[model samples]
Target: MDQERIASAITRVRETLAEHAAEMRYRDSEAIATIEAGLRVKVNGPHGASIVTDMPNGVGGEGSAPSPGWILRSAVASCVATLIAMRAAEEGVDLPGLEVMVDSESDDRGLLGIGAVPAGPLSMRVIVRAQGTSDDARAREIIAWGKAHCPVCDAVERAVPVQLTIELPGS
Candidate 1:
């Protein structure tokens, strides 16, 4: 990991936000998606990037690409992994091997409309594997700090307001 670069970047952002108080309120990203084919969608990410998402054969999709739920889980796992690396860098700790895994439990009855259960995941588990020399306590501290500071982790764990507007061709 590039500790110096991460530390420098964090310092720059902190200083910038401190000076520009108005700019400190919002730090956000966006993704847009449109239905492509049966149970398939084309998503546009930041900077003109793109990805395809499709449901499994059970859901009438061609199984061409990963499902959206899988994508969400992957994002959670990767985001936490990144947080760990950033934290390590900031703390000047060296971690040779780091692995993070995320799992979520949900009830299909919610989606199938067979029950009143929520469609969202009912629970989530995060597994982290890494070791840094300083001390076991220090390593735990870093990992906890990373997870606690992770934006995705926080979003999933807490409730955030979503403002959405849908436009139709003929209304």
Candidate 2:
């Protein structure tokens, strides 16, 4: 990790925020996905990274890659881990090892239109394991701060309005 570069970037971000007040620049991210094979999708991001998503064989898919729910969990876990590490670094905490685990349970009956259950996960859990921290109080503080500061964690905890539009050919 390039500490100097990270410090410089953080400084630049602070300066930008200070200059812009509440009118900060917006960062936009987009992903494109194309249907691969049965219940599989190939998603391509702007960073030249691609991932294959598929459903389990029970759900009429070959179970090639991870499901969308798993991907969401992975995103939450990875974002929390990164935010914790970055915050620890900023606070001069020497963390040798950090692990984050995220889990959620969903009722698929709603998706399958079999029952009146919710289509999303019922609940989510996030667990963090950190090494090289002696003070349990400080470690708890850091973990709490990380949870509050992580954007993904915030999004997951709150309900954000989403507008969906569908376009079909010849329609």
Candidate 3:
């Protein structure tokens, strides 16, 4: 294991987070609501986009909108790819033409109105394809670093904490 390389990767990610924190706060400056079955987000502003996401049933839309779950999966894969590239570069591992596909599965037993079998984002599998010098070794390293660095993967693996507030009509 390359300790110095790993340290460098961590430093770069920290710096990136610090650099983007303010911009994120500025851009993500709205709030929304949703029920327990899923999450409905209403980002107010001309540039904001309103999104309704559910577990498996799908994201509702007016006229041919993509499913939210699919979007989420895409986001996960994209994040993994980005993190892998960044970590691999820092680790002195050459990576080229990298692409990742994320797949998720959920059982519909409970959704069929049966007993409460508990449904959620069950499992996510990632398929990575890339070519470069030291491709195999870099692929291995990227697989490891991707699981460690991706925020979406972290949210899925580590279970991020979320707090919800609802406004009452009379209040």
Candidate 4:
């Protein structure tokens, strides 16, 4: 119930992270994931391309695209949705429709023309929608809680340290 105590706790945790940052590594792993019986993914890509299984309805994608990054982004949105839903439920709020729209900007200056953004997704925008029962204050509170709980949102907002290791096939 004390804001000062909560703030102190958070500060202590962050201090711990800073103390152990040098020992931290961005550990990576992969697993074979199947979407439906038809779509599968060869998660560990020793080769340049990952094999895709049967194509979806009409996209001809074999229901597979680049993994890891997309999966992380989807997880971000899912985290937001889940946290918001949980908060709303706890507060006895009813929402008819809820959605999160996320997009990223990439730079293609050299590859494209002038004023092109960048070569990677520069930013993401999430628009949350909710039709609730006359509880706008609770809705806003839920949204705030969602933002506060999302790991991806916290990482981006706080600029977490990242260590990069690129392993070429022969390297």
Model 4, poorest ten-residue lDDT window? 52-61
Ranking 2 against 4 by lDDT, winner: 2
Give the per-residue lDDT of model 3 (tens digit) for 58-103. 4233323345557778879999988887777566676677789899
Q: Which stretches of candidate 4 lie over 4 Å from their true place?
A: 1-41, 44-69, 109-119, 164-171
Model 2 per-residue lDDT tens digits across residues 55-156: 999989999899988998998999988877766666666556788999998889977888789888889999999877877787778787887788887888
Cα lDDT, all candidates: 0.85, 0.83, 0.67, 0.63
The residue pairs found clashing in candidate 1 are none
TM-scores of the candidates in the order shown: 0.91, 0.90, 0.63, 0.52
Candidate 3 lDDT (Cα, 0 to 1) = 0.67
Candidate 1 residue 68 Cα shift, in angstroms, is: 1.0
The best candidate by TM-score is 1
Model 3's number of clashes is 0
Ranking by lDDT: 1, 2, 3, 4
**Distance from true location, Cα of 148 in model 2, Å:** 1.4
